[model samples]
Target: MKLPTDIQILEKIYKAHKNDFEQYENDNSIRDNKIFVRVDLLKIAQELKVDKDIVFGRLYYHLNHKFNYQNAGNSHVKLFINRGDYGKDEKGHEINFPYMTSILAGMQYERRKYQMATIIAIISLAVSTISVTISVFL
Candidate 1:
């Protein structure tokens, strides 16, 4: 079977790895990564017309949990916003282009497991595997 193209792979990776990327943003060691989260929340606020404060409050809590930050206070949020890694590489290279690169990687990994499930379902004449994919992804 043919493998997915880079774009397709990235799309899948984006879905699966979005959480990790979010954690990356709140991690001071990776502060440059914060832009992705910042813009993402900004877009949500713009589109939903939600108050920025509320949106930030919610995002802050989520970020704190995901990043394992012991302190879930304004200071931590501020630090993450101001000094967290912005998804940069060791060479100070920002991986901003592949916003969904991590998700795509995860999708590729899941694809094999999914394929196996498909084969199993086909052999067993069970439709659950296809349904599972559709339900989870769609």
Candidate 2:
């Protein structure tokens, strides 16, 4: 099995939750023409299985051109796993850079992901595994 790269994982997650990113841009875009999506760095860090700083650095480094803002990427997109983290970090640092204001601004602007089917499938898989384990052991 081949492991997915950090960028690949990010792109996959971004595509899944693209609507949320678009919504963020729609609600928070400073200009009508320019679109700067507000991404959850903490989430990306969790999905990448690495430090959030690494993901942030990678995105910033790649998208350095015309990207003079904060806490946003204008070039590449990535996955976010920290469902709990939206606008603030553990230390309560201001997550929003310029337009993404408020503590829950990130989550507030974005729409919820439709993962009910996946969750149900996972539950079914777990139940089958548990049944097999019980039959084998007992």
Candidate 3:
């Protein structure tokens, strides 16, 4: 398919990872949808002077988390799947999934922050309970 310039680049990247992306399809359509996200993130990373390797690493994390790591993770592929065209294979339905590194990083960082907050809240609650119990005894 004749994808836009940006999408063409993205399609190339997706095709590059044919082994990992084969489950989606041997087709390069996955690259088309993911290109927008990768380019946008790359632009932002360039603006921020972030290393491309770092960005790519995070992107890989997103892909693994979305596809391989099923437990305790959201369906990251669903968004891209909704954006692009997917067809059924000999097995079943397949969709193109794009993993944005920045987003994946942010999601992990946010999850950590939430876990920390929950821990703090639990500690505070326990301290309050202990304080109340001591006061009652006193």
Worst 10 residues of 3 by lDDT: 85-94
Q: What C-alpha lDDT do the candidate models reach, one value each?
A: 0.44, 0.46, 0.44
Candidate 3 matches the true fold with a TM-score of: 0.36
After the best TM-score superposition of candidate 3, give how far the Cα of residue 79 lies from its true spot, in angstroms: 7.5
Residue by residue across 111-134, what tens digits does model 1's lDDT show? 888999989878766567678888
In candidate 3 the C-alpha lDDT for residue 6 amounts to 26
When summed lDDT is taken over every stretch of 10 residues in candidate 1, the lowest stretch is: 88-97
lDDT (Cα, 0-100) at 41 in candidate 3: 36
Clashes of each: 19, 4, 2
Relative to the unseen true structure, what is the C-alpha lDDT of residue 24 in candidate 2, on a scale of 0 to 100? 58
Q: What is the lDDT of candidate 3?
A: 0.44
Name the Cα RMSD for model 3.
14.6
How would you encode candidate 3's per-residue C-alpha lDDT over 34-138 as one tens digit per residue?
Answer: 233222334433544565444344434444345443335563333232222212212222224344333444665777899999999999999999999999999
Predicted structure 1: clash tally: 19
lDDT of 2 by residue, 41-121 (tens): 667567667676666555445423223343455644222122233345532212112232221234433423336666788
Can you give the lDDT of residue 11 in candidate 2?
58
